[model samples]
Target: MLIDIKGVLNLWGSFVRFTDCKGYPTMQAFMRESPQEREKQRYLPRLDDDTLAKVDRQIRKLDPAGKAKAYLANLAKPNDKREELESLESDELQFAILYLRYVAGLENKPIWQKLSLSKGAFENELRLAERFVEGVLIGSEIRLFL
Candidate 1:
């Protein structure tokens, strides 16, 4: 009277497999974490000598707050809020900064508007802006991606 649970599930177009009924429902969940969760999580890759040095110069000239402000400002969109934060998540902020640095250009409106960050958050982001930017640049280089 044993059933081929895997075969039955497959026939029903539900392909999850588990040892028993007790493990059934949870097997199909998408909440499983990505593979990189256990390892040291690196957001960006290594930069070439020229790019690395250029980035150093850029970072050196900017105070933490200023860099954060600038990086965020570069990401703000047209007609974006002057004092509102963007919807970008914590992890996405690093990528957004790269877009700001290598992709988006400056315009007539203030940089904060484009970055869509409130003053307080922008200031807070500055404290770690350099690290975020470095991670993105380095990771992007390592992956041969932008």
Candidate 2:
């Protein structure tokens, strides 16, 4: 089957959100919402074991800091690349790491709250982060399992 890159990324985003929010009462209530309401939310796809293993390996090859720096560099045009790189916090990697962690069923509340992002904003960030990682992998000629 041809892979739906955007759909897979979106599903990963939802998986992150679900893992992050699952422990909270709010999330529980949301889950308990009517089937129609639940259906409105995005659902994660179930990949085969081999595909999942390959995806996980590809994901592990990512350098979070490098990815974050590249992402920031793209956003700032005609800027001092060295200065920008020097100023980057290791935490900047959290943008991608948090999403990956969420997919792994891990949650980091501090990072999630620190951004103070609305659901839509957070999802957008996750999408960008995923794109960055994908670009890095492809640029390096690494095959994406997804």
Candidate 3:
């Protein structure tokens, strides 16, 4: 079966939201801000103590990591694709997942710098990793043909 690229990208976005490590609201907030604004906000750090406590309480209630793992397991199903994802080289998988996760507002320069990847190389690797993830989702038969 042929997979729709736009559908996959949309699914990938939703998957990233589902697996959000930083809490969904926080991720959404970050997504809403521009990169420069995010950087400024990071430096300025504007949450009040009560708000911070409330956020902490919400985080404790949410258990995002457990929820994300459960969701990923369900998505992977019989294929054990989550295991395959985990088995990828640390940089490759981390970059791919993070790239997808922060698709809304993340800047590539910082990530490439952190990963010690040249711009062109990082882009190439990220593309390949995304393709791999798409294959994993579509299944072994499709992946083998690819």
TM-score of 3: 0.37
RMSD of each: 19.5, 12.9, 16.9
Estimate every model's Cα lDDT from 0 to 1: 0.39, 0.47, 0.42
Error of 1 at 88 (Å): 1.7
The digit string of per-residue lDDT tens for model 1 on 1-146 reads 22332222122121111111233244557775333222222222332333334444443333333444444564454545455544655444533443343334333133345556665665455435545544544544422222
Q: How well does each candidate superpose onto the true structure, as a TM-score?
A: 0.29, 0.34, 0.37
Tens-place lDDT per residue, model 3, 1-146, is 55553344443344345445453243465466433211211111233333223332332222334443343344447644434333335433443434433443347776566445688876776666556554544542322111
Winning model by lDDT: 2
Evaluate residue 44 in candidate 1 and report its C-alpha lDDT on the 0 to 100 scale. Answer: 28
Better of 1 and 2 by TM-score: 2
Ranking by lDDT: 2, 3, 1
lDDT preference between candidates 1 and 3, better one: 3
Instruction: Mark the regions of model 3 whose C-alpha exceeds 4 Å error after superposition.
Output: 18-104, 140-146
Per TM-score, what order, best first? 3, 2, 1
